[model samples]
Target chain A: MIFPALRVLVPVALVIALVAIGLRIGDALGIGPDPAFTLLAGALFGVLLQRSRFCFYCILRELFEDRDSRASYGLLVALAVGSLGYVAMFGSWVADPGAGRLPPDAHIGPVSWVLVVAGLAFGIGMTLSGSCISAHLYRLGEGSVLSPFALVGALAGFVLGFASWDHLYVETISRAPTEWLPARFGYGGAVLLQLAVLGALALLLMRRLPARPARDAAAWRLRAVLDAVFVRRWPAWVGGAGVGMLGFIAYFRTSPLGVTAELGSRARTLAERLDLIPGRLAGLDGFSGCATVVIDALMTENGVFILALVAGSLAAAIGAGAFRPRRQPLHRYPLALLGGVLMGWGAMVALGCTVGVLLSGISAFALSGWVFGAAVVAGVWVSLAVRNRVRMRLSARHPAG
Target chain B: MSTLSKSLRRTAALLLALPLLAAGQAVADGPVVSTSWLAERLGDERIRVVEVSVEPGRFERGHIPGAVNFRWHTDLVDPVRRDIASPEAFSKLVSEAGIDADTTVVLYGDHNNWFAAWGAWIFDLYGHDNVVLLDGGRDKWQRENREMSRRPARHAATDYQLDVAKPELRARLADVLEVVEGEHRAALLDIRSPAEFEGRIFAPPGIQELAIRAGHIPGAKNVPWDRVVRDDGTFRDTEELRRLYADIGIDGSDPVIVYCRIGERSAHSWFVLSRILGYEARQYDGSWTEWGNAVGVPIDNPAGTVWGGT
Candidate 1:
């Protein structure tokens, strides 16, 4: 009620943002990157995210508390479908094992354990913060109070991350390999490994479809394999495919789909200009390199891509007739701020978010995604425990406030 | 409802609604030309291409057949700061480049079309209705087919008409700063990376002060410029573009001021926001490069950022 229009408009707005991202990437590459294509895709995502109520937190919660994996199943299916598309288009990796350029920031380079710890931190932190990196990206579009804090915190965490780099690099990172996916399983093997692993997960979800009726309608997303196959109908799949296709096409334009590097560079630029920080943040620059930041500085590249994603999502929201923004209880603001800071910190420490580090990394056949995802989930759980105790204390005190 | 249900409901509902009218001209039908289209128009005396690349002399070293090098850092931008050239001076520069109201101009350069876009912004500002940025730029052209490079450019000067076309299209430094301060509620857009917005330190000295105390202009939003571009330096579609704007808090009436250090990068975003997606987007030509380093402007950077907004 506080921000009425925003509440009703948020989801759609977020979808539009993503679609615009696609279109912008399209333009950056000059590959007929039509805003229309991204627009429609955004609409589709809006519809899906809205209809399915897809939140990784909810999925994890169900899995953790109710022993339900329905939401998790849906997510896996989406990833499987999308990852297949990514590999099919780009192939495993460029030729010349030693020479070819891999996807930007996809692999966790020489920071294996640190990355794993970061991922776990993110996973758990997302739960505690009440949203994952990708979810927050869109949720902010929807006017979530906690979203801003999370974002701010992320920024703070990144700034602070500079302080720890020397240690992270010397003790934890220097000894590790950057491209674990390649080291463990050559390019071809890694691509195949993804298919095998995710393919298996997809099959497991398929088998669970029959038991859906036993669970509450809200709890069960689909009827396992059959519904997973047919329930979402063509639109959801199309929308998901569109995002995946956009991801594929993104490879042709600038770098593969990434959000963190851009965010990081933007953050760095602000710190320097505003004097919010010292002129330099120490080891971060050398670790990341100038080309990466320069690409993020591109006005028409990542900037437009993010724009398209949001705009496209908004359009999708409009088409499906579900575009509306809703304000959550204001009491959540402090928690939101705290949560945001943690997630932001985690994202910074880890070098990316779910979409940035995890998804992008996975697509590149990088092992860092695995590390970040797992660690973030762990962090989320830890945060959630803290929240539970706080909630209990609040309930004991005022019962409602 | 619990947070989960609330989130799910919001997501579902968002997937189900209708949006407002297309963000005014936020839906840009800006012309995108292929290398082929450029080649066809190359030799025509009426056409001029502007090479806007980042490298020191990328434009001077080689360019499209009949193109002129527009040094984003030097010519199109104010030497004092990232602010755009004054209108009178801007038009004269256009003419000096052999471009006119009727000149069929094509823009392209290295690093996708990032630099090239700054040139396009120049055209838009001066009301040169006949300019089009080469889609996919030379990088893509080189990939799909053979590429052409003009011999190093030769100096040519002509008396150009300092035509007053549309001064309103630009966002003055004051205007940008005002919006950033949340005075006019102008949607301050950082076309740079999140790091840049967060003051992660790496800003060139010229634009350091414009950064907010904490990070970002308290109310400013970020939409990295790369989001608008592709790997091969091409752009995405319109529908997608609209979505991108929505995601980044860009509303048609939001009064957006897009900026990057010297405004060259911001110009690229300016094109995307104003030209493609058709939002009332203006480029803060002075960007951080000027405002950040301005003598007495309010500067905010708390030692907590990478660039430090110093």
Candidate 2:
């Protein structure tokens, strides 16, 4: 009885304390109400994310590993919806598309072979770590032991990325052209091209929908709504819409929706404070990435959003009675750490993760997004093949076990 | 389970309170400003916004309402020599743009603001009073849904008096050679790509910016010029910038000389180091073109065993 009560009390206390702290910091910084609003918005996003399990890792895992693509449609819907939002915001600029003047700060990077390497590494990392950066944040709320390690590894990866960026940027990234679809095809053409591709994929996935249980003839449909909203799984379409709308709202209200930048920022700040990193990293401040430095390190818009995201997930998990901790083998911890390293490095080099690069980038009509997405899929396929081989080998060695 | 639950609740409460304990104002008022900052001060009388781009008509298409166009290649660069324009020519360019000595020129453009930084470096070279790079360049402004106009700006040309061109602001081939010979203890910053540092490929695959031989200056560290900025083309905060260079042993105390293929990319670094971080830094405009081609000068080729042939 006490444990159950503690769950409710703890999250409530956390929300109140966090809000108070956020407000205090905002006041101190003279940023007014921006931090508080972002905090609350982040919480909402977290709740939606937790309730729907809107994770890139899980979606891709199900698609490739389980031979199920139902959840994958959520991502497609997100892109489709997000692309429309971007079009609405960027329609005027797209009216005149020139090679020299592509839409700026849209997460579109130079299309290069490095993208394939980054994607492959990210896929391997996701498989090993069991979650993407965004997924890990929500999972941390539900008390996943592996998330913290993965995040730490991601931080380390960012540092490593900085170390190696000189070679990558000068050699590979500079060699390739930044391919923005709108620059070549114009805004309408690019949006239509993207929609057609996404729509076709969505239609194909719809045909492969999992069989649903027959409804009781006398039971009301509203009865199922509660289960969908609270206890049971949400339909792919609902999750898709929810995630899509959230992405749109995030971009509309603040900057692009990204989780890794904040992670990188905290890591860089901590490392700098500890004197672990260089006093001046050569040319690191200028290039565009999700991990741009913030004025208020502790109470940045992204930081608040990330915190609320975890809190929101915790709330949802407790409410749904799904906050139970899972038992795992000791070996999984080390493996997860290794996975985290790969994820951090991959995301750092790729300039964003699945959410930042694949979703947000494509939505902005950046060809780098398409390149990353394709590479990630290929990586996932390769990793699945390797996993299957390993599993088969293990079974062959110990048939009884 | 009860003990675990109790501890979890305590941890949650503590985590929530962490923000209140946080302190320090990480931002500093300096050369870089956000689109919002510039937007608020858009029509200020003392500020002059200059749109620098390689592409023609980019400013004509849409720009910050009052910004004048500065064609970096045609206007800033000397049409004759592979060098920045003469002081007299630069004076004419800025004076025509309605900028005087005290005018705070905010430079912004596309192409990762490379040309803008180049413009900023040129202004600093001639000792312009206040020159700044618009953080994230025009992209951030556009992304934020800020106001833009197609009307070409016209201003009363002022006789902007330029101070004597500071030769110390620039690193000549002789200075680079001194570092190469180990006579001077300075950080040689090669802002070129790694492949260029190594003798793998000459210029970027497409562009004509190339050297006769590949590789970096001896003792020069390869810190690609793009590393100093975020993906949106904004300079990183001071702390981040400090650690980035410190990590590479560029603590800003030692005199640093930055260079690239033809000095365009390195100019961006020079701006960041000298203007943003206040480092004792200089840009070697001759860069690889001079270093890579000059006879009898030592070159460090990482890709192959060969030194300098051509």
Candidate 3:
């Protein structure tokens, strides 16, 4: 038992120590403390995501298929918490909430039909791939064989997005409205309204939640504590609250909590280098989501954050004994790739993935966020229904098998 | 001393002083300085370093030691109008930035000194006599691992007065229109990317300020601003620059009017033409934004691209 426990504890401890030392060295090198802080934030986020199993697609699917509203509640709680934190930050940053000027570097993207289309595609991609982009990152730590193919597919999708960007920009995105909730209602008003909406949704979801088993009271013991920490999956609300707090802290310290900026930037840089895309992608830079740029430096803030996120998730997964690598069937590879491509293109067009546009956007109280979230939900629902119908028909035809 | 001997002696003295005078003038009036030159004179009281990067908060992150930051949007332009800063505002800005009449202002910035050249143009407009661009600007300095400081430099403020505004240095919309209509003899130089010049795109991706229409002024020669700079962001030698322009019949004999999407990029080209290669040039500060958006301006768009159309 001691040897087995050491196998989990030693690696996790080494990871934490290495992170601490890396932060110190990074600060000493004159890159400033922002990168170090971002690394820490990403690590914390990874641990929370992995331990809580806070996957957007998984939660939504569970709600639709199994009528499990528990994980969905966690997501709502995260949004609510994030929204409250954002309002507080916004209040301090811009005293007059009605001011037309947006808080700098917030994920307030333009609202348009393109965003809806992107969100739908992303949702469908999530369904097909079995994870959202953020989920793929965490699950990569969990040794998901398909995550690599999906990520590669996403890179290709970004290239495709660059190809299609100019026409779309001219048609719709150029004229799209960037709606900030605080601009319409005051900070207090905006938070309250968002909370009310979230509350209503939460109540609606609660009706579908299955009854929980009563907890058996036990005396406090070291073994029990270790089991709870390392063996048991965290409650949905705990993960939701952790995620929300992290999002707030991330925005306050660094930029917004985004995972795809680095990925998109890499794709953009590569595409530009290969001359695969046009020299100019019109209106791509003006609007803020996860704005992609041609690579100038080896390490960007987002790049470092993502690297640390993976590392942190790996540590958590190891400790939880959840880093189980399983061989997937051959056919699932193609689906993962296709799904990744869809998600990549969607994220590129929309300027962010689930974590970037939906989570961060909604927290910042941008109307685009809510629109994206609704569209994503509708997409997931529709795709799941269609898939279920297809499966049923196939099974009906092959009853003996 | 006889009269003949006195005149000969005087001539000899004047001839001896010619090279010395020329060298002194070069030191004082040259429009661009290399990094080593500026680095050697880091703490010289007569020199002031100014950063005018397009990206916000870059100055705060790190800049050349003792350099002051000037935000392009608010500091360089009129807050209320779509124009350069008013005379009074410009005076106040210079005064607050510790610039004086005798100060040799060394300007540098990010994006290969795109906005820094704009600053130089503005300085020229206001007739600052001793201003020079730091050759290669901030990019080269940073790439070479020069020292940078986050601490804001504190310098004693001086009452920096604006000299007579140089009107010939700037070209207005009417001036560009006259050139387009064949009334002016000046050569029209569009310094935007080929895509922008050919009307395939309205503006560079991610740039907010855009024209309603896409294309260049009719008969304008396309030479992207970046053609003047090397990979390291330093300006190419005089001979190369001259050859580049001479290919399009701009051999410095003809007055050149340079323009880009906005005036900033054109200012870079204007710096190259007027300062580096000694050409008679005026920056059409209005540029494509003014030309393309004007109600009935004649434009030569090869791609035939239209706004809101495929």
Candidate 4:
């Protein structure tokens, strides 16, 4: 009883303490109240994420590895809800696309062949690292040993991405189009198009989702809120809806929901300050991609947001008695690190991670989102095949096991 | 309840309640006005709204009820030289637009207010006393679901007199060269993409490369023009803008000359520095087109080689 209570208490106390400390630091640095807002938003994101397990990698792995598409349906639900919210907020632009105006600050980036390559690398990285960037944050909160190594690797990958950005950008990205659907199709047409596509995908995935057992009276009652919050994994649809709502709220209140901006900027700033990278990072500030620049202060809105995400996830995990920290084999650390580097590089090149590029990007009616999403799935397919082949060979070599 | 569980409950409540407790408004009065502010003052005889979007149809389709169209290319530029309209021509345009010396001219547009800022810069150059930009521009108004009208509101022509043009507020190629060579006491800021600044890529695809070579002015610090604004196209608070420029060693100690490919993007930065941050800043309208092509002038092409011939 004491252990269970302590587990819950410790995470909550730590999160509050961290947030308070962050606010104080932000105050000293003169960033104002944005840090507090970001941290709270992050914590909320973490709680929702921990309870739902709404990770891109996990969802994809379930679909491919277990032939279960429930999580895939969850992703579709999220897209559908997010698109509706975007439409409501951005209705004016949607109503009049002839204005030739696109929504400012949306996750839309330039569509190029470089994006496809980046998505593929991101997929491979996600597989090797065992989680996407957001997932890694939440999972790290739950004491996942592999996350630290993956994060470090991602930092290294950002440096690599920064270094190679000039060459790739000059050749491929410079030629690509940054198309918004509402610009080509009217706002109504774009919304209808997204809804139809998402609806069809949901139907397709629904057929593959396994049936569930009947729930008891207590499970259906008001007590279910508590049960769902602290004792059970939320249904995929609920998780998806929650995430979409959060994304909508975050966009309206602050910036669009993104996890990589802080990481990318930090890495870029650190590298440039250390003289490891050049002062001018080409095309980074001009166009909409995972853009990073050095700011005067150490703590940014994104940094606070991400930190709070981890805290929220920790609280949720501990409350639900799911804060399991498992040790990994020493050899796996290297692979995790490599995976992180690839993810970092891909995310930077692509301008966002899975959620940032695919989810938020799509919701904003950008075609780049679809392109990145398709490329990532394709990359995952190829990596899975290669991994399976390697595993088979290794098994054959050690038949005694 | 157990001690741990009780404490956890209190912590959760405190975390949720913190936002409410941290209450203070940062009333930043930049050279900007909200949609509501404009709405309340709309149709007032003294307030004139000028829409300066790149797309021509936007003004035709609908706009902030009574905004006059100020096409950056056709209306704002001089036909003979690749420069802003002559003071006489600008005076006529402003007069035609019914913007007198005392009139409160509010400018707005799309593409993150790129052209709007350009219009504001030209107005400032001509020394307009009361000029302001709509924060977040036309997008913000539309997003707010405010009233829009297709019926153009024409204003009677007024004699818009200019005593003198503020040439000091507008940096020429020569002024930029001085700042670049460190001969002048000013901050030379290149507000272009990193690739463009580093000479990795010339112009973005589709646009003709203005400069014979891809690069930036020497000793000019690169600060991507978009840093001063939020995702919603609205400029950040004054405190944030102050810190961003300060971090890059850009204080109000010396004047700042901002430039981009054609001076449009840099004008946005100029608005931020001069209007928002209240700094002594100017836009180099000649920008890369003049800098990159000029003979005997210095060009810092780090990645690509500069062309030898004209």
Candidate 5:
């Protein structure tokens, strides 16, 4: 009954409450707060994401494993639009200004070996966990009892991550530097290089041959075209571009692109405030806090956009009647849990996840993106190898999971 | 809508050739429900009340009628796996709590419903679609002058099914390690305090002899958990939640991992960001204890950082 008035009213009301609380807490903590507008946008995004399912894990799985690369369309659209917007605003934010490389926060870090390694771990983990970090949250909204374990596991990985810092800094990423940006290629060259790559990849991935191969595609389905107009549908090339653009726009708005940092950083502050976690870890006490340091963190326009994607998804899923709360398999939870652990550990090691390092990095022309992307593929393959070996061992004669 | 408004809408649709999509308010199953709605529902037999709480003994003191106790940690997970309970175990456990496949579990708890929503998260993880977290949880329930039962109720157990088709939803230890190593797909998030993050002096309650060097992972940022929730236990406004994350450098787009010491405190945050807020996020199960205890992994102490040798 109240849905009509609630949309605008709720957001406004929520905004008021948010500002009041933010100011109150900022004063007590003695930390200067960022402008409320950005914060409000972020909150709306949170609400949107919870409602939608704009998650990289969901989209990626749908693309590669399921051959249903529709969800990623929204991300691509976001990237395309955001990219143009970012390019328009890049000068004020960059050191060289002319380099198409707007900055680190716009897209992914760039191509790198470790990035691929970490991506593989995260990808496999999502397979096992049944929900990526973001999806895991929405699942919570719908009432899931198992997400907490992933949380516990992630924390453990972070703590354990301390044990691996030296290797991470030295062996894993001693040379993982930004790549592909205008800084390296110069403005025109960088733009041309990116366009060339995206165009080629899109062409190959989206090739269409005999319609008989895919029944869905065989039929002259108006739904596909309609979906393009209304919702995300087939041939996610355009969507991928959008996502890339969104990554571009994110940093142009004056902050880096990311998701885990805001939540993770907040978790740290909460633990400190409550005395649950020790006041120090990794030597940079105040360096990583949301109160004092915003640069190193990943929260910003992209955070809010994340929510918008979710909301957009929610709108689509609900509209399509495909929104059903599901029950995950019991036997597979061990794998899911372990996968989650790996994702946490890998995210810890890599300093970002697929969305941060791969998607954001790639869009930003950072070398880390390629590295993580490739690493993730390799990691998944390694998992396949392990699975193969495990099957061999478990069933010398008769095999199974 | 009025005739003029409807006419304008029609005109815009015909002229623009764009879908006139409308998204209603994102309604919770129950958002800030009144005390009366809750009271009436309490007597309904179809509503199975479950007290999913943090800490021990609280359920015994007083609880909603017919509610069973489910600890946020010990009762739901295999102490070692970094994800949700095994479906086999979850089915058995939830059933033991008297939850049937269709049972609508109305969960509540002590502080701002962290454990309660967490309980809800568990149900979702197990494929239960009918679970609900009581707004205000026990605190608001009590403040609203609702009744409480001091005696523990004798309840029956029911079955639950956690489908395995969605196994790709979680993050694993390797995933966390990858982030630490700066692999880059998804990053490990340390939602510990600044001190804990820096390895200055965090030994979660009983985690003595953390002989491992003290510090957070090199790239992990420290955002406390409660920033996601409010002081009164209700969730902060959506915008507040957004800013909280942004300030901490967390954008909703990237793959994110949230963690705390035992994951209980951090569970609150996981609930807020991933659950309530809907970011593609997961929680670290083992937390610091498991992380710091191992050798040759990774560690970042506070600025005065130190690492325990392998």
Candidate 6:
């Protein structure tokens, strides 16, 4: 038992030590302190997300299919905690919320029909691909074969999005209203409104949640401690709270908690180099949701953060002995590729993914966040319904099997 | 080897070196200085390097050694009003930044020296003849892996005075209006994006400062400011720039009025025309913000885009 625990503990300890040394000497390597801090924050977020199974698609699918709203509750708790944290930060930053001055680098974005379309596409993509973008990133560490295809498909989708960006920007996105809740309702009022909405959603979800199971008392021993550390999954609320705290600290110390900026930037750069996209992405730079730029620097905050996230997830997955690589059917690959394309296009048009736009946007009290979330839920429900019907029809035809 | 012969030889040597010295001074007095030129004279007493980036905190992160930061929002512009800094304020800023009448101020910044060009305009307005822009600015320097420092530059304050504000270099709303009404005989150069000039969008997609009306001043030629700079953020060669401007019929014959969404971008064009090409050009700093928003002003919106209209 001690030997197994040591195997798990050593790798995790080594990862932490390496991260510490990197942070200490980051400036010398042209990685500024801000990006270094982002790396730390991203790693912690990756661990929390993986341990709690905090995939938005998984959470929503479980709620709809199994009537298990436990993970949904975690998402709600995260939103509630994050909103409160944001309001506190906003209050200190802007004495008067009505002053029309927005906090710098928040994920507040424009609300428009394009955003809704993006959200819906993202939802359907998540259902088909079996995970959201951030989830796929962590699951890559868990040795998921589909994640790579999905991510690559997403890159291709970004190029497509860039190709279509001008038309969309000219038509509707240019005129879209960027609605910040704090601008109308004060910071306190905005946070209260968010909490109320989250609370009401929590109550609605609570009705469908399965009852809690009975727990057995266990002796406090070394084996039990080791098992809890290396085997047991963290509770939903614990992960939610941890994520919320991290979101606040990330925003306060660096920029917002976003993951798609680096990916989008890379895709944009690749497209530009290949001449697959226009020279200038029309009006792309002005909006704030994980804005992508033509890459000039060797390291960006988001770039380092993403790399650290994958590393951290790998470390955590290894410690838990959950790094299992399995082969999948050939047919599933195309589905993942298709799904990734949809998600990539959706993320680009929407200006972010679940983590950047939905989580960080909601935390910033942007109306776009809530609107995108609702649209995503609708898309998922509709996709799931269609899939179920197809499966039922196929099963009925093969009743002999 | 007599004393009289030795003195005669020395005089001849000094005469021979005069032309070389003057040629060197001519290069130093030009509108733009190369990265190598500035790099060699980083700590020279006569030179003062100023960084005026569009984005905040860029200077504090890492900047050229011995460069002082001048935030575009607070340091360059008027704190409250939508205008350039006043003469008195400019004087204080220059004096505090340790710039004197004779100091060769080398301005550089991010976004291809967009705000740094504006700084040069400001310095020019105050009759600082020795001011020049760092060619390619911060982008090129960083790309070349030039030395940078996080330490704030410290220089003893000088008693800099604003003696002559060059009104000829700045175009006001009335001047632009005259051009729009066909009363003025200057070339109206719109340096904003084509989408902006055509009224497809009010401003750049995410830009907060906007004009209610969308379009260019009637008859303004659309040559985006970015065309003047190479991919590396440096200005194009003189012959190429001449040919590019000549295609639009903006020869040195007629005075040119350059304008953009705001004044900063136009200042870049203003630098190219006035300083680089030596054209009789003026920067309409009020630009589209003043022209597009002003009621009863004539606008030629090619796209016919209306606010909140399908």
- Please provide, for model 4 over B68-120, each residue's C-alpha lDDT reduced to its tens digit, 9 standing for 90 to 100: 88778778887578878777888888898887877888899988889999988
lDDT of 5 at A365: 53
lDDT of candidate model 3 versus the reference: 0.85
* Candidate 5 off by > 4 Å: A1-36, A43-53, A69-82, A95-113, A138-148, A170-176, A208-249, A266-324, A378-401, B1-310
Which ranges in model 6 have alpha carbons more than 4 Å from their true place? A1-10, A13-17, A28-33, A219-222, B1-53, B56-310
A1-401 per-residue lDDT for model 6 (tens digits): 22567557755785877578566745544343365687788778778877787889999999999989898888888888888887777765555768776666688888899999999999999988888899998888777899998998888888888999999999989999988998998877787788889989988988887878776467368887777665677777888988888888777676778788888989999999999997688788977778988886787778878877777777777777777788898878998898999999999999999888898899999998898888889888989999999889989999874
Docking class of 2: incorrect
Clashing pairs in 4: A42-A309, A282-B194, A282-B195, A283-B194, A283-B195, A290-A351
My TM-score estimates for the predictions, one after another, are 0.49, 0.58, 0.65, 0.67, 0.43, 0.64
Q: Which one wins on lDDT?
A: 3
Report the lDDT tens digits of candidate 4 across residue range A112-205.
Answer: 9889999999999988888888899999878799999999899889989999988888888888888889888877899999999998887778
Give candidates' CA RMSD values in order.
Answer: 21.2, 17.6, 11.1, 15.1, 27.1, 12.3
lDDT of 4: 0.82
TM-score of 1: 0.49
DockQ of 4: 0.04
Weakest 10 consecutive residues of candidate 6 chain A by summed lDDT: A25-34
Compute the TM-score of each model's chain A versus the native chain A and list the values. 0.72, 0.89, 0.95, 0.93, 0.65, 0.95
Per-model CA lDDT versus the true structure: 0.59, 0.77, 0.85, 0.82, 0.56, 0.84
**Which 10-residue span in candidate 1 chain A carries the lowest summed lDDT?**
A288-297
Give the lDDT of residue A369 in candidate 1: 64
Q: In model 3, what lDDT does residue B6 have? A: 98
Instruction: Write one digit per residue (lDDT tens) for candidate 5, span A19-136.
Output: 6744544322212112333443344443444333556666656565566645555555544454455444443334363534334234434235655656777767765665666555
Ranking by lDDT: 3, 6, 4, 2, 1, 5
Better of 1 and 5 by TM-score: 1
Sort the predicted structures by TM-score, highest score first.
Answer: 4, 3, 6, 2, 1, 5
Q: Who is ahead in lDDT, 4 or 6?
A: 6
